[model samples]
Target: MEYIASEALINARASTVWEVITDAGNLTVWESGITAIDGELRNGGTIRIKTADAGGRTLRLRVQQMPGEVMTWTSRLPLGLLKRTRTFTLSLQAGLTHLTVKEEVSGPLAAFLGNTRPDTSQHLNEYVHAVTNRAELLDRAS
Candidate 1:
């Protein structure tokens, strides 16, 4: 199991950040590392996400769940010789929103990730950047 968690202090309120984060189509705006997000995004709905990291490696991900505050996905990529289960959790604290990303992968291919996950680690930063970026975007939108 591998976990990467990042928190950010947004000038905007948590609800504002949550609205931006929940806008599935804006993944590229805030999370530049992700190439695309597709499918019906709703509670218990399955979706497919494509990620092209800074290294320009395109990876495919299948989302498992996307209920409020909790999003789970599965990657065919191996992590410690097992299929990886990734989860993104969002919480509101004070005026800021906290996001935690968790992953567990087991498979021979998972070895590709090794002990370090560049994409997942990058995602931690993305979460933080996304919230703050959205806050500013929203400010301008208003």
Candidate 2:
């Protein structure tokens, strides 16, 4: 399996961070490379995402979440040939919120897709930064 992860300490409450992340409409504002999200982010929901990196292609994913604690989005190829899972975790540390975002790809076809997969390290970092900024800004406004 191959994975990319980023972590940040956000100057906001866990609830604020979770609210920012779970709102699909707000994703385009903070999630780097994502242009649009077509669907809600909720358990058993499906969303189609348009990204700058996909050349106008849309990626569909299934959503599963534990409210403010964790959220996972899974995208899979037919017959389990390839699967990608992106998880977001939020926790309170002292007076700040600790956020971790990770994406893992695995399956029988993972080796094949590895060559085609674009490096997402920078994207993940930008996402974390944007989220932290947005959440902190909102936290202050409240």
Residues 1-142 of candidate 2: C-alpha lDDT, one tens digit per residue? 9899999999998999999988888788765568989999999999999887777889999999999999999999999899999999998898899999999999999988755766677888888998999999999999
State each model's CA lDDT, in order.
0.62, 0.90
Task: Give candidates' CA RMSD values in order.
Answer: 3.7, 1.1
Return the TM-score for each candidate structure. Answer: 0.67, 0.95
Pairs in clash, predicted candidate 1: 78-110, 79-110, 81-106, 81-107, 82-106, 82-107, 83-106, 84-105
Instruction: Measure candidate 2: CA RMSD.
Output: 1.1
* Candidate 1: residue 118 lDDT (0-100): 60
Q: What is the lDDT of residue 120 in candidate 2?
A: 74
Runs off by more than 4 Å, candidate 1: 54-67, 76-81, 107-112, 115-119, 139-141
lDDT of 1 by residue, 1-142 (tens): 4445666656665556656655678766665455677765555556666666436554445655444477676656334355767676767777566666666666666656675566666665765676678676785677
lDDT of 1 at 64: 55
lDDT of model number 2: 0.90
Best by TM-score: 2
